[model samples]
Target chain A: MSMIGDIARLPAGVPETAARPQVSVATAEDYVALLKPRVMSLVVFTALVGLMAAPGPIHPVLAFTALLCIAVGAGASGALNMWYDADIDALMTRTAGRPIPRRRIAPGEALGFGITLAGFAVVVLGLLVSWLAAALLAFTILFYVVVYTMWLKRSTPQNIVIGGAAGALPPVIGWAAVTGSITLEPLLLFLIIFVWTPPHFWALALIRTEDYARAGVPMLPVVAGAAATRRQIMIYSLLLIPVGASPWLFGYAGLVYGLTALVAGALMLAFAWRVWTRTEGKAATTAARQMFIYSILYLFGLFAVLLVESIAGRVVG
Target chain B: MDNKPDPTELTEEQKRSRRSRSIAIAMVLGVLVVLFYFVTLVKGPAVLNRPL
Candidate 1:
C-alpha cells in the first residue's frame, strides 16, 4: 500500500497533520547515522579479535560474514535505541543533533529499519555461520533494546553497568561463530568489556551530568553525584586491571599481551584515580574527560594487542 | 486562489531522499545476493544441509 494512500485513509477525529502525507527529507547518511557507526566499529573490532583468537581456522568468507552480521546486529540495536529514545534524545545537547531528534527520520521509519536489519543479520548469521552465534546476536539485540533501553535506562543509575553485558557479548558471539561453542577465553573477553563499561561511561557522565539531569536520565553522576560516581569508576577500573590480564594469565596469550595489559591497566587506574581525586570545578571535568578519552584508548590498545599477538602466534606456529 | 502546499506533492528534498533510500535498499539487496552466492560456492551442495 502507498504511504500517501494510508495517510488519506486515516479515520475521523485523527489530527489533520496525521492525515497529511509527511514527506521525509532524510538522506542515506541520516539512515547511516542511525546505526551509530563509531560504536559499531568498536563492536566489529572486538568481535574480530574474538573470531581470530578462536581455536582452528575459519574460512575468510565466513569470517567476514560473521563480522558483518555482528556489526549489522549492533547497528540495528542502535537504531532501535534512537527510535525509542527520541524524546530524551531531543532533550540532551549531546544527542540533540541525532537524526531522529533533528527530525531527519521519523520514529516509525527508524523502528522499521532497525527491525528489518536485525532480522536480516540474525538469519544470515545463522544460515552462513553457526546457530549459536546467531542466537547470541539475537539475544544481544534484545538485551540492548528491551532490557536496557526500554526497561532499565530511565529507572536506575546502574543501567549501564547491567546493560554493558549486551555490548560485551559481541566477542563471545564471534568466538561461537568460529568454534560453534563457548569457552573460557571468549568469556574473559566479555568480562573485560563488561567491567570496562561503567568507568568509561561514568567518566562521560561526570562531564555530562547536567545533560543527563536535563534529560531526566539517571546516570550515576546525575543520580549519585560526581563524588560517588568517581568512587565507582575507581572501583571498576581497579577490577578491570585483573579482568583485562586474564587472557594472558590463563595462558591463551603470550608475555607481550600480559605486559601490555598490566601497563595499560595501571595507566587506566591512574586516570581513574585522577577522576576520583579532582572532584570540583574545571579540574574535575578535565580529569573526567581525560579518563574518558584514555578509557577508549585503553580498550583499543588491549584488544589491538590481543589481535596482534593472536595473528603473530598463528603465523609463527 | 489558495497558497497552501499540496499534501500529496513531495518537495525536491523529499524526492531526493526517497531516491537515495531506494538506491541504498537496492545496494543492500545486491550485496545479500552476492553473499549468498559465495556461501553457496564455499559450501557446495552441502549449503542446503544446514544443522541447527
Candidate 2:
C-alpha cells in the first residue's frame, strides 16, 4: 500500500498516533510577540523620564543600561503574564492573536523564556547599576507576575487599580538607578501613572465588556456594568487632575509642565465627562474609545514636557 | 514495505524558524558581551567595589 493510503486507512482515533511529537515552528517574531513590545516601550519611556529627572548626573552608558534592564524586566513580566493567562487570552478578541493563544509558542516555552530573561535582567542591573534599582526591578516583575497576574487579575474588578503599582514602579526604579534612593519626585511620577491607569484601562474595558465577560475575567465593566464603570472613570479622572498637577504644586516641575498638566488634565476631564454623560448606544462607545486614545496622548504629553524641561535645565545650568 | 515520512523530522518551515531563533539568541549573547565590556570600562577599577 502507498504511504498516503496507509495513513488514510489507519485507525482514526488511535491514541498512539495522536501522541506523535511535533517540532516547534515558532519563529523569533513569535518570541518577541510574547514579550509584548508595546508595553515595554511605555515602560522604557517612563523609566527614561525618571532617570533624566533625577538630581545627580548619570553616565550615558549607565543610563542606557538602566533603561535596558527596566525594559527587559517589563517584557519578562509580560511574557509570564501571557503564559499564565493563555487560556483567557485565547477567549478574548483583543488578545486571541497573541503567540500563546495562536499556539505558535508553547506555554512552557514562554514560561522558561520569561524566567530566564527576568533573572538575566535583574542580575545584570544589580552588577552594573545600583542594587537598589535592581531590587526595585525584581520587585516590579514579581508584583506584576505573581501579585497582579496571578492574584488580583482574575479575582476582583479593582484588579488594574492595585496592579497599577507594578506599572508605576519604573520611574521609581529609574530614579533609584541614578541616586540609589527614592524621593518625593519619583513618587509623584508614580502617583500620576497610578491614577492614570484606571481611567485609561476602564475606557478599554468599557468597550470590551463582552470579551471580559466571556473570558470570565472580572474587569470593572464586566462586574459593575457600563454605567458604574463610567461613573468610576469620571471619579478617577477627577482625582487624576489634582494628582497629575501635584508635581508642579510641589515645585518639582517648571511652568511649562504645570501649564501642560492643567490644560491636558482639563481635556482629560472633558473626555471623562463625555464618557459619563453619553451613556447610551454608539455615542457611548465612541466616547470611551476617544478617551482611551486621548489617555495615551495625555500621558505622553505630560512626560515629554517634564523630560524636555529637565534637559533644558541641564543645558542652561 | 511502507515509505512514510518520519514524523520526528522537521519540515522546511520548522527548520527555517529554528535557524532564525538560533541567530537571534547568538546576537543577544554578542550584545550582552559588549554591554558588560562597556560597563566595566565606565566603572574603571570601581567595578569590583559593589555595595549592598
Candidate 3:
C-alpha cells in the first residue's frame, strides 16, 4: 500500500498570497475559527467530566483556570494545525473555507498566535494548577502539532490511530490538575477515548475518502481501501465496547454508567456493523455518515453519564 | 512575507473588521496581563521565602 509520505510543499493549491500578498486582515470570527471551537467544546466537556469525576475537592477559581488553560491549549494546537495544513486545507472541500485557506488570516500570524497561546496556556496551568498537569498539556500540544500534524498525518495510515493519544490526554490532564496525581480511574477514561477514536474517525474517513485522496492524506479508506477500513472500524468497535465499560467494572462508577456504556457501545457496534456489511455506494456512504454522527453522540452520552452519576453520588451520599 | 503586492486589497469593510479584531486582541491580551498579576498575588512569595 502506498502511504501519503511527507511533502516539502503541498502538491497543489498553494494560496495566491504566497506570491503576491493580499492585504486581507482577519476578523474576530476568523480568529475564533482558527481555534476550531466545535472540537474544543468536546475537549472542554470531557475535561470537565474528568475534573468532576476525580475524588477530591478543588477551588472553583482554580478549576476554572485549569479548564481555561486546557481549552486554550487545545485551541493552540488547532491553530497550529491550520497554519501547517493551509495548502491541504485549500485543496479539500471540507476545509476550503477555513480562515487560512479563505485567506482571512496570514499563515505567519496563525503560527504566532498558536505559539503564543501554547506558551501562555502551559505557563498559566503550571502556575495555577500542578506542574504535572501543565507538563501533560505541553505534551498534548506538542504531540498534536509535531508528532501528529507535522509527522504522522501525512506519513502513514496509522496517523489518527497514534495521534488519538493527544485527544485522549485531556481527561487525564484534568484529573491531574485537581489531584496533582495520576490513578487508574482517569487512565481508564483515557483508554475509552483512545479506543473510540479509530472507529469514530474511520467512519468519516470512509465518507471522505475522495477528499483525503485529493488532499494526498493517507487516511485509512484512501490507503487501505474501504473494506479494510470497515473491518478496522468493526475491530475497534469491539475493542471500544470492553474499554468503555472498564470504569464501571473497576468500581469507579455505578450501574447507570455501566448500563449507559453497554447500550451506547452496542449502538456504536450496530452503526459500524452497517458500515461493514454494506459494501455498495450510497448505502455504505449513509452507514458511514450515520456512524460518524452517532459516534459524537455516543462519546458525549458516555461522558455525560459519568458526569451525572458522579454528581448524583456526591449529592446522595 | 510576500514582497509583491496584489491587485486586490482590503475593502473598507475588511479594514474595519481588521481594526475591530486588532482591538479585540489587544483587550484580550490586557485581560490576560491582569489575570497573570492576580495569579501571582494569589501564589504569593511564600514559596520563594521557603528554606531550600
Candidate 4:
C-alpha cells in the first residue's frame, strides 16, 4: 500500500521535460495512491458481508485473512490501472495531479507494485482460505487490470457496464470463502452491487465530462453526453431498488434490512431524478455530486442493516 | 510522462528534492511496518476470537 508520493520517488525510468514538460519524476507515495484505497475499502466491506452471510462456517482467523487478501487484490488492480492510465490521467483535470502524470511515480514502478501485490494476495488467500476464493480474487485482479483497464476502457463507452463484473465479484468471493462455492445468496449480493455501479459511477461521470474528454477517456458522459448519461443513471437507479430488496424477500434478511433498502432506494431515485431534471450548470454538478456521495451512503447503509439483521437472527434463532 | 529529464538541468535541485521525498517515503513505510506488526503480530490473533 505505498502512497502516490512513494512511487514519485522512483530514481530512474521517468521521463520529464520531454512531452508536455514541467514534469518531474514520480516519488514513492504516488505509487501507493495508484491503488485507490477508498475504492478498495468499499470492496472489502462488500466482500466481508458476503463472507459473513454465507451458510457455512469459517475459522475467524481465515475469514480475516481472506478479507485482507481480497482488499489487497483490489488494490493491486487499482495500481495496475494507474500504471496504464498514467498518460491519460495527466490530461484530465480530475486526474491530472495523480502520481504518474504529476511526475510522482514512474509507470514501471506502479506496474511492479501492482503485480507484486496481486501475486501476494492470491498466495495468501490460497493458503488461508479455499483455493476458490483465491482463484476468484485472481480473476478480479486480472479482469480489472486487463479486460477493463487495457481493453474495455479504450474500446467502448459500455466499458463500465461490462467491466463492472470485477467489482461485483467481491461479495461472491466472500461467500465462497465460507461456503467454498458460489450460491444464490452471494449472487444476490453481487447483483445488488453490479446494478448499482452504473448509476453510481455515471453520476460522477456526469460531473467529470470535461475531465474524461480532456483525457481521451471514453467515459459515458464523454461518449453519450450529459443528457443521455443522466437518463441511463436514472434507469440504473430504478433497477437497483428491486435488486437491493431481493435479499429480504427471499428470506436472507429481516424487516430491518427491507425497510433500509426501501428508504435508501427511494432517496437514490430522488437524487437520480433530480439529476435528470438538472441542466448543464453548477446545479447539475451539485446534483451529480450529491448522488455520488449519497449512493455510497445508501450502499453502506443497506449492507449495515443486513449485518444487524443477521446478528439479530443469530441471537433470536 | 516525459521520457527524458532535461540533461541541461543541474543535478542540485533534483537531488535535493529527491533526498527529501525519499526520506519522507521511507519514514512512512517504516511507520506502516511498525503498525502492521504491532497491530497484527501482537494483537491480531487475540482479536479474532475476541467477539462483539
**Candidate 4 stretches greater than 4 Å from native:** A1-28, A315-317, B1-52
* Candidate 3 lDDT, A1-317, residue by residue in tens: 11123222434676644423234467888998999999999999999999889888876767888899999999999999999999999999889999999978889889999999999999888877778999999999999999999999999999999999999999999999888899999999999999999998999889889999999999999998999999999999988887999999999999999999999999899998999999898998999999999999999999999999977876776
Models, CA RMSD each: 2.9, 4.1, 7.8, 7.8
1 or 3, greater by lDDT:
1
Tens digits of per-residue lDDT, candidate 1, A1-317, equal: 14677866777888655556677888999999999999999999999999999988888999999999999999999999999999999999999999998989989999999999999999999999999999999999999999999999999999999999999999999999999999999999999999999999999999889999999999998888888898999999999998999999999888999999999999999999999888889999999999999999999999999999988877887
lDDT for model 4: 0.81
| lDDT at A112, model 1 | 96
Q: Which stretches of candidate 2 lie over 4 Å from their true place?
A: A1-21, B1-7
Give the higher-DockQ candidate: 3 or 4.
3
Model 1 lDDT, residue A134, Cα:
100
Mark the 10 consecutive residues where model 3 chain A has the least summed lDDT: A1-10
List candidate 3 stretches off by more than 4 Å: A1-23, B1-11, B33-52
Itemize residue pairs with steric clashes in candidate 1.
none
Estimate the TM-score for candidate 1.
0.94
Clashes of each: 0, 0, 0, 34
Full-model lDDT for every candidate:
0.94, 0.93, 0.88, 0.81
Model 1 stretches astray by more than 4 angstroms: A1-3, A6-21, B1-7
Where does candidate 3 clash, by residue pair? Answer: none
